[model samples]
Target: MCGRYATTRSSGTLSQLFEAYDDTDGRHRPDWNVAPTKPVPVVRVDDAGERALSLARWGLLPPWATSPSAGARMINARSETVATSRAYAGPFARRRCLVPADGWYEWARTDGGKQPYFLTRADGDVLALAGIWSVWRGPDGPWLTCSVLTTAATGALAGVHERMPVLLPPTRWEPWLAPTGDPSALLGADEEWLAGLEIRPVGAAVGNVRNSGPELTARVPDVPAPRRAREDPRSTAEMPLF
Candidate 1:
């Protein structure tokens, strides 16, 4: 459910951080409000089994899709069923990738309106979101695409939303992007890692994709409306795996 996020790093910077060669060909630009259908940077193993930083459309288009528009709804793949889902099974087994983001935006319902919150690493490190990709051969040429993976939100995130992107730690990044492995083993939320995230209430400017900049991530005063009660933490364990 990570519909909007920020990734302002250059391809070169990401290449160095992820230890992947830059294959984006300098087409990448800083994006503070990435939306569906936009191109995004993804780190994956190339044909030679070496990691490469490449640009992929935000949504995933299965090889058999007739229209590129189908990608909109395919922006996120639920971790629990990705291995068996028709549109994701193949990519889950062979085309796993790491989606680097500065942070993600989640909206919490309030009496007045929806309040947007920005969740990022407390240490200011980038988040390597779990992802799967596919190469769709269209009439023009091959279209590279990808989808973020989501799981039941745990720890502090559950209060904001029942689901969140599968954020991978550095220790699990290699296992996730490896050619093969039981992805399910790595889908669970790591409490230690989750505790490192800082959730800041930010202005609603982020809700509009057209607005982009450091200001979008700046903290703002909480709405005066009654804040929703913290969702029962115990309910997290029973939440359906996304």
Candidate 2:
């Protein structure tokens, strides 16, 4: 499960890469360790059929949910049941979105302990983790929540973990972003695309949400004890996702 990841791209670069209109409410700080429940950038087709780069709470809250807190556990939806699951079927049919990430973090158990690794495209392409979203209303107001889709890992990733986010390829981006019916055809894991992926061990600091820096993702030989991550007072609140 992708409980932690990084999205260190500048807003300008992502706007052009996804050809999306910048819809974030304010400046988004680069995050090397993004955790669930935090608002992260997402690219999706608006009703106008134009791709818009917007922020969304990382956890998905079904439209019928009674409490916003339910979102935390809904951070990832399994691919096998997404089309039929009560919580995800509606969004799968109409609210598809592409989650932007430089890469994601996955931990592997070894003789020493659990070691974290950062996975990214070998050519440095941004990962569009397939996602579904919902618009939920509560006492506070309406919220745009999203969940990343996961499938059994295939390729180098398989040795790391049995499941990983369904990373979308550029060729399918247009169709997947179309605001229409279910696009299950475009939601499967792609080994051909995964062939170009690169994985490397990084500091254990990434396990801490307080960590925010390029060094957290810096490749390390073998992480023994990760350095303590500094805290950001303003980070606890989700960033604006307009």
Q: Give candidate 2's error at residue 98 in angstroms.
A: 0.6
Q: Candidate 2: lDDT over CA atoms? A: 0.80
Q: Weakest 10 consecutive residues, lDDT, candidate 1? A: 233-242
Cα shift from native, residue 89, model 1 (Å)? 0.5
Output candidate 2 Cα RMSD: 9.2
Best by lDDT: 1
The lDDT, on a scale of 0 to 1, for candidate 1 is: 0.87
The segments of candidate 1 whose C-alpha lies over 4 angstroms from its true place after superposition are 224-231, 235-242
Every candidate's lDDT: 0.87, 0.80
Q: What tens-digit string does per-residue lDDT give for candidate 2 at 16-76?
A: 9999989886666678889999988888878787788888899999878898789999999
Candidate 1: Cα lDDT at 232? 56
